[model samples]
Target: MKRYPIRAAKYAVYLIILFFILFALLRAFGSASPMSVLWTTSRGLMFLGVVVVFALLYPFFGFTRKRLTFNAAERADDVERIMAMCGFKRIGSENRPADDMLFEAASTAKKVAMMWEDQVRITTDADGVSFIEGNRKEVVRAAFRMGTYIA
Candidate 1:
């Protein structure tokens, strides 16, 4: 079986907090017209919060990490360029065939979260380049910081 990065309790807590956030939104703004909802609704605001906060805080909490591994398609230090674009620095590289890349970054990439390490596993395929952290779910914020979120 594939091992999950987070424990069950943590997932439960994360879900509970998400529900609470939605509930709070419901309480704060539940009486909107259908037209306004079509344009932009309270639910949209909640979604924005979900993406911004989760991306900013997940690394701060040390919930996920990344590693660097290169395939035959990659050139030397290409991984470093990718990570740098994403606001990470190549701290240590093992030069091994597996998990040979290492990076360090701050949470929210604002120079905060010194206690946390922004580890990123650089995965590039024919589809596009990707950064996978703790789980299969794509955390876009943690990817290479494109403009606002991870691209």
Candidate 2:
């Protein structure tokens, strides 16, 4: 999976704010005998709290923007390349196996190709099948491969 730098920065900013708030609360409520002790404790607590918050929120904000040259579209192309590596071809664009044949192949062979109107999905032993969604071809391909055929 790709990492989004902007989201990471946002998370950093959130942590900073959280740290300050925690530090302030500690200073406001704790003993005032030793300033150094208070500062050190507050800093430690702030760092630990921020780490915990980041861990809790990572999955939700992790994949917003990738710092890669490849955008979602390029990622889709990569997915297509992977499918080709798996002996899967574009449904109408390539000399692909027939629908029934592909289905049977998927059922019996260790690998299979699944095609949908908007996507192409593939499964192989080396690279397990994945479902992709959204405007990316990879997502679409994944969706096709993993999607259940609905009458």
Candidate 3:
């Protein structure tokens, strides 16, 4: 499963809010002693800290994250290269296939293309192109520009 950075961040924010709410409730209804309040607050902070850490690390550790970089132009070129590698031939208007197998293959190919598209993003710069994945936008040069072929 993919863990989106924005989603993780939102979850972290929610956890922080919940921790504060719990701390407040505990303070209001629990013991009035300084030690008890401090202990409760510390525990709440620890829980919030753990959530924050996990959120920050999720992008780096997520299995669905593809760590690759390319600029807009290079990205376009890569797409072309990948299409060629996948043996994707351009369908002519006059020779369009009208069979069920063709339709299934097209649908499957569209899904695979979408998956690759989602795995990478291209950003342009004066220095050239940069690729970004999720929240970590870093320029990587050794990306696998290969498309998946569904038979």
Candidate 4:
């Protein structure tokens, strides 16, 4: 959650900007004192700005569309094992065995158009393996932690 601090800082700055802008607009056209106008509009305008920002960003960051690859340093089987240890379930193995390597990030009961989560396709063979896309650092950390939890 190191990113949380950065995001929070950005939000704080935005709120301050919004407060000043609203205060200025209200003072320019209204009869109220600057301090009185701020007292009246500050909280409501700040909340509105924050809501707009959140609504715009929630879908973008909460459900990201990224195609990230694994580095050459990682091995093929190890990658597969790590994926399995994490929550990703294979797409298919019965009709298309090789195609089973394609996986969506979430293993929830409802499967949609794969829009709800990230996806990863692993290409492994006698040749060295590489990933088409995945959340790399978090995936690696989770997989490594799995090693300690196995009975």
Highest TM-score against the true fold, candidate: 1
Q: Which run of 10 residues does model 2 get worst, by summed lDDT?
A: 97-106
Taking the tens digit of each residue's C-alpha lDDT, what string does model 4 give over 88-114? 655664544452356665555423322
Arrange candidates, best TM-score first. Answer: 1, 4, 3, 2
lDDT of 2 by residue, 1-151 (tens): 3333444555566666765677677779883334455347876667667675785566354322111222223244454444454344444424442211121112223222121212233323223322222224334433343232210
Q: Which consecutive 10 residues in model 3 have the weakest lDDT in total? A: 96-105
Tell me the whole-model lDDT of each prediction, alpha carbons only.
0.45, 0.39, 0.42, 0.49
Off by more than 4 A, model 4: 1-41, 54-77, 93-100, 105-115, 123-129, 132-151
- In model 1, the clashing pairs are 66-119, 86-144
Model 4 quality (TM-score): 0.36
- Number of the top lDDT candidate: 4
Error of 1 at 10 (Å): 2.9
- Tens digit per residue, CA lDDT, model 1, 6-70: 33334445655675666667667974334344229777577556655564455444444443232
Residue 146 miss distance in model 3 (angstroms): 5.0
RMSD of candidates 1 onward, in order: 11.3, 15.8, 12.8, 11.5
Instruction: Report the Cα lDDT for candidate 4.
Output: 0.49
**What's the residue-level lDDT of 4 in candidate 2?**
37
* Residue pairs in clash, model 3: 70-131, 71-129
Cα deviation of 4 in candidate 2 (Å)? Answer: 0.7
